[model samples]
Target: MQVMEPVQMALPVTLPDDETFASYFGGENSLEVSHLKSAFDSLATTFQYTYLCGLGDSGKSHLLYATCIHAQERGLSTMLLSMREVIDFGPMVLDGLDALDVLCIDDVHLVAGNDAWEKALFNFFNRFNEPGKCLVVTADLLPDMLNISLPDLESRLKWGTTFQIRSMSDDDKAEALVKRANMRGLELSDECARFLLTRLSRDMRALLDVLDKLDHASMAAQRKLTIPFIKSTLQL
Candidate 1:
């Protein structure tokens, strides 16, 4: 008799090291942040599936990763998947994910209109109903707004608490930049942070990308972050 061997699997997405609750600047979305944090809190007597909706770069991905990180720190098996990255592999990539203690899928909206993907997600959603496990999903639109071909999948997405992370104001964006700079051990003063807000794209992702460049430039130049340094390094 021939026996089948075990199947080896790996999550196709990498959760960035910097994407943590401490490093995330909630800005005006503190209530949303609190809801996510509470969902992952171990002391809580119950676990709830969490769905986060927000425009691109509003930290939906950040919060998803943060939940995975929190679960891992508690010695739970975690998987982070991005539809944008793994959809090319087909819906089979989602197989066996229901066994994980925490399963986080980002850009779930990308699966919209794909019957195979939507059906797979709907089944996966049903399998995660076991106690002590969590499934966190994020999309750029509300569950009702997603173009999912499967009505059950759309309904499943809204089965749990949903939070919409609102866009940050200009002042909040400036403060967020400074907070992120501080997380990187850079001394970004209010004036410099405000200046960056004015000069860079308003999108948080773009601002963070510019910050990465500025962090490198500051290190290479052996200078503190200032308007002059930023102007010279970014040529803005």
Candidate 2:
């Protein structure tokens, strides 16, 4: 297999804090992914399409990715395309891919105002919002708020079941950490976890960064992760 060099995008500013880092799907505890499953369950299957939207860190990508995984497991043919990678398809190519049994678009909000991509997606959606194929999209905001040059594209996206994920609560954050720790076979005391919650910022990405650092440190030092250890290692 020819391995292509990995693509990287530098953050515009400093990276997010520890708390926000841990909240993404596959980045932390998949246990909390049940939130997406419950939302999917409530979706009315009348339209052959759906849109899941929310702000960054609101779990939109997580839900779409998780649902795609679930549907694939159930023998559905799935095609998941990232806007960053596939935007070159422009409007014309993308407009014709309505035949897939399932289609999941990630970070579609990035393509919102692009003329070619917009026209393509809108046409693609028009063809797919029918009997069986489910065209699913995940974006950073509600359709009406997205700055797409093609106004029709916005309305088309808002056509089907739209579910939003509220910003997670303190309790949800802690539970997510616990679940991630357990998944990694690490033991985290409630006291230690709570300490992180209070001392650190609520950014999920930052939280995962700390946890990742802790994991690597624990392995190298062959030590148990205690509150003292975390305080000293991450300077939290």
Candidate 3:
């Protein structure tokens, strides 16, 4: 008789290198950050299942990516799935995910009104709840607030420790921008950071994107992150 080989599950997304806990500036969401950092530890028994919710660009997804990175660094099997991207592929995409040591689902609220996905997720949640397994989910709203059609799935989501990741203040955003720039080998003055915040969107993700563009443009022009250079390059 021929032996049947176990199927391998292909990850649908790649974890960004810069989204680790070290690169993240927790700001007002320090408690959420701390919980995620230790969620995968052998001694972190209470964090077996965790949920994070916050508005857009509030660093919820970043923390999820950071969690996956932390788990993989410890030689554990991990997977981070974005519900927004995988919802179109049907619920079969969730198959075999329970085998992972750490599983993170981002933007789970995207699956709120879908019956098939909801049922599949509920089943997946039960199977993934065994010993030594960690499941972390992120959504834009609390489980009770989400428009989840399945009552059981909604209740299961709330069963875990839920945290509301608060948005950072303007001062913290400026400091975080400066720190991120420093990480990229760029010298960004506090004044310049604040200038970008004022002239552009205050969202951290948007600010970081602008910073990335500035980084490349600055390197190419051998210029500093001056306001004039920013205006010329980004047409701000």
Candidate 4:
């Protein structure tokens, strides 16, 4: 018997160590989070073609990366491609991707209205329909709302279960910031979190980026994440 190996690609992107499910603050997106976490289970047939749609900073990319990490941990062959970064490389970037046990395409809507990419994705979807293969896609819009010029490609997008990641409320965002801080061994009070929210962009990605900067700054200065320290370190 010939042995088969997992398909390995030299992807330009790297997943963040902190973007796992444990660090993700689900808030109102608990169901979507749960579904993505189990996407690779043997009995998760309905999740073979999962689609996540939401506005920017609504955690779509985070969930996609988290799913890939989960699948990889289970010893499954997994690949995560961010279309936003690879669109310029042309549709050939998707070549042989179906060979992986799990494939996650981030910002898939970036290929919308591009004929070649759309057609290539349509074909990839068809080729990835095997029983054990799972395809997870994230986009800023729903399948029907995408500006895809290819009718068949749009139809293929709807073949899977779709979930809209809801935006986090202010209180939820504050709580999430504190939880993320705790995960990093930093103490971020609810008041401090609310203060940071007021001072920085409310977008989760931006907030997280700022939090990362604070994490570094606090470690260097050996200072807690107090409002005064945050303002001085981040120039807020």
**Cα RMSD to the true fold for all candidates:** 4.5, 7.1, 4.0, 2.8
lDDT per residue (tens digit) for residues 1-236 in model 3: 12223222233644335777777777425787677666665533543889999886678878877777777777667777888788899999998777777788889999988999999999998887776778889999999899999999998999888988777788878988898888888999999999998899998877878888899999999998898998999887
lDDT to native, each model: 0.78, 0.64, 0.80, 0.80
Which pairs of residues collide in model 3?
A: none
Residue pairs clashing in model 1 are none
Of 1 and 3, which scores higher on TM-score?
3
Ten-residue region with minimum lDDT total, candidate 1:
1-10
Model 4 regions more than 4 Å off: 1-15, 27-29, 43-47
The TM-scores of all predictions, comma-separated, are 0.85, 0.67, 0.86, 0.89
For candidate 2, give the lDDT of residue 4. Answer: 23
lDDT for each residue of candidate 2 in 17-53, tens digit (9 for 90 to 100): 2222243534534433544344345334534566766
In terms of TM-score, the best-performing candidate is: 4
User: What tens-digit string does per-residue lDDT give for candidate 1 at 136-227?
Assistant: 88898999898778889999999888888876777877887788888889898989888887877888777878888899999998999888
Candidate 4 achieves a global lDDT of 0.80
> How badly does each model clash, as a count of residue pairs?
0, 13, 0, 0
TM-score of 1: 0.85
